[model samples]
Target: MIHKREFLRRNLPYDGRIKLASYYNSRHVRVPVKAAQITKAVRWHASLLQPVTGIDPAQLSARSLRAGGAMALLAGQCDTNTIKLLCRWHSDAMMRYLHQQSLPIFQRLSSKMFNNGSYTFLPEDWVPAAAE
Candidate 1:
């Protein structure tokens, strides 16, 4: 994807303003994608994928691609700083983009927390069963 963007940047004539996400218009001129065009494309593709993916076309938008990329990087164990740089996030605001932190991460954290604190949430009136 980066290589494709770079190839478009170097090859396309855009008066020194290269757009990473662009398409050739019907007139054969490459132009930057507008917001509406991106939304339309996302919806169109989602509709096509709905049968196999079972994803609602209405649930996807241009922003879904950004969040999905960030989630993919997080799931791959990429460092937060690298994700921030790649996502062009200026601050810790990038954390908000990671809304769906997976259950495994939470489970790992919970185990670590309980072990470090020497604590458990068992009921006070409960007792261990006899070995049988």
Candidate 2:
């Protein structure tokens, strides 16, 4: 969801070819990066290395952040459907990870549901308040 202005700002000018030809003739143009590099670049930009915070970039890794995100999602009551969509996981690996992480919450929810007399709740009585 990058804005067009941001894209233009970050990218080489559309007229770069004319400028490059005048400046550096006979030089090979760099090949376009693969999708993996693009993903990595975006991830790195969004990582824990903030200039204001002065956090050491060496202390952060994509894998650690990914694991932390998964754990946070589990704690935040995000469902498997949401996780699958967010993480782009097509296999059962995410399910296994979520199951492992969410075992305690699942157990508690199951116990609560079972202990209740019925799973269904009674409809709330609705009354329209007088207009102010």
Candidate 3:
């Protein structure tokens, strides 16, 4: 990805302006892209990935990227406030996106549950001395 960006930077005539998404027009000149175009491109790529991923192309769109990022942050144990800010979510709606936890994470958590060791308080026969 870095190499592709470098190639674009070197080949395009952006006049020192940096833009991640752009394309050459019919006149062979580079033009800035619109949000819709970017969304379409993302969905197109998702469609190409369907065969290998077994995910329906219609189930994914550019919005999936944002949702995926939120899920990743949740899995990383990021605070809700930070995730909300990063995802630009104004409300607690981001909570809904956190419903799923990866199986590996659950397995690790379950393993740690009993491996942390066990302890008990003083027995019934034990008594504390009075503080004179």
Model 3 lDDT tens row, 40-96: 887788788888988876776667777789989878978779999998999988767
Among these predictions, the greatest TM-score belongs to 1
Global lDDT of each candidate:
0.76, 0.59, 0.72
Decide which is better by lDDT, 1 or 3: 1
lDDT of 2 by residue, 69-93 (tens): 7768878888767777787777657
Alpha carbon lDDT of residue 45, candidate 1? 90
Q: Deviation in angstroms for 87 in model 1?
A: 0.5
Pick the lDDT winner. 1
Global local distance difference test of model 1? 0.76
Give the alpha carbon lDDT tens digit for every residue of 18-55 in model 1. 56677665555667777778879999998999999999
TM-score of candidate 2 on Cα atoms, chains taken together: 0.42
Error of 3 at 20 (Å): 10
